[model samples]
Target: MLRLAWLFVAAWVVPALAAPPDDPLRSPAWPYMAERYFAGQTVRFDAAVRVLMPGAAEDPLAVPVYVDAGALADVREILVFADLNPITTILRYEPGELARPSIGFRFKVQQATPLRAAARTGDGVWHLGGAWLNAGGGGCTTPSQASGSGLWKDRFGEIDARLWPRADGLRRLRLQLIHPMDTGLAGGIPAFYLETLALQDSDGRTLARLQTFEPVAENPLLSFDLRGRGAVSIRGRDTQANRFAGTVAP
Candidate 1:
């Protein structure tokens, strides 16, 4: 009887392993991305953390992306990447205690690839959400539009930002800066972009930090949630050792 039960278990498991995966999005790049990004964590494609991108990127240079992991609680870190891009990482965010899991930004897409966001909770599990994007390619390989137009040259390191109070006492911050953010994939162009940014309060206490990467859209864009309505400053640096500092008041 024991032998028969073992055989029954094996029969059920073998076919299940042989069958195709039941991933909701059925992402073709999940296997490779899993090994590259999350090798040992429990991961599943969950709709609760929405990763919204257009079906087709009309402009590969600047494709808008929205990641809303607001439904999840105690999110430790969030990672945004493209599976097939030359430079995969777009943003690595830590919500910490003040901010929400939702963000709106733009990025570069090399070609048709899977745009993914993985949110890790306190439980040590990474929740994944993504969708395939269709593109004609060349977002990474071309010179930045801002750079080509020479606007970023005159306005380099200029940080323009706004902070607004919400009905619930939270604050919303939208920031833009002028930078080439070159990926270096394009011929003769060296990579130069904001490497790190920290959001801070009046006392210089760090609210949160964001790790920006090469694939992030040129003329860097960022949206963040502030827990308090107090004055906050955005401080950052680029690859060339240039410093950026700006204060936004309520």
Candidate 2:
């Protein structure tokens, strides 16, 4: 009876695995969306922020922020500061945002916060995108999942790379490794992700440098768009000296 039940479960789950990826509604992260946004909330998109404070601080109180238009065409609801919080709240839509919608403004955050942009498409569907950032080190100073000293000694020379193809001959490349990017003594967990990513062309001219952290979602999927006509090499070294390397061409 146990064996029969196990087979029954596999028979149901196997077909689901064979389906295509990119089904946003069925994704593992999908549930988090509904938990974040709900009915009657107006969705905000492509917002610009202006910070009215003493030197671009991330504090919620002092920062003055809002969308550009007062009454959007089809706006159903509006949600502000859906990213980092003990303070995120939904600004619901009575009708919806403008028909040909776009928004921009300035705001302050005490630290880098994750920002979510959602649109209720013409087909009555919801689309979502997000950006994660730090107002400062409060999030970066969290504890790490691995140990210092030991992971450091063994992680030397470890490297991993992934190349994702994009339209218009652009390539998105990410390279990461298993090292405790320790900040020399402070030693925070999630705080220990890489602080900078430096990429170079085959000839060694620098291409790009990215600011990041462990909250960057494990193994560090560093992505950037680049144009090149030859061999490209990528390498990353964290504050803790954890290094990774890879090469790809398009």
Identify the candidate with maximal TM-score.
Answer: 1
How much lDDT does candidate 1 score? 0.85
lDDT of 2 by residue, 143-212 (tens): 3335533565565446566656567565555455554443222343333445555566777766554444
What clash count does candidate 2 reach? 41
Q: Per-residue lDDT for 12 in model 1?
A: 95
Q: Kindly give the stretch of ten consecutive residues in candidate 2 with the minimal lDDT sum.
A: 91-100
Q: Give candidate 2 misplaced runs (Cα > 4 Å).
A: 1-143, 148-153, 181-191, 241-246
The alpha-carbon deviation from the true structure for residue 140 of candidate 1, after best TM-score superposition, in angstroms, is 0.8
User: Which 10 consecutive residues of model 1 have the lowest summed lDDT?
Assistant: 15-24
lDDT of 2 at 91: 27
Candidate 1 residues lying further than 4 Å off, grouped into runs, are 1-23, 149-151
Q: TM-score of the candidate numbered 1?
A: 0.87
Best by lDDT: 1
Which pairs of residues collide in candidate 1?
none
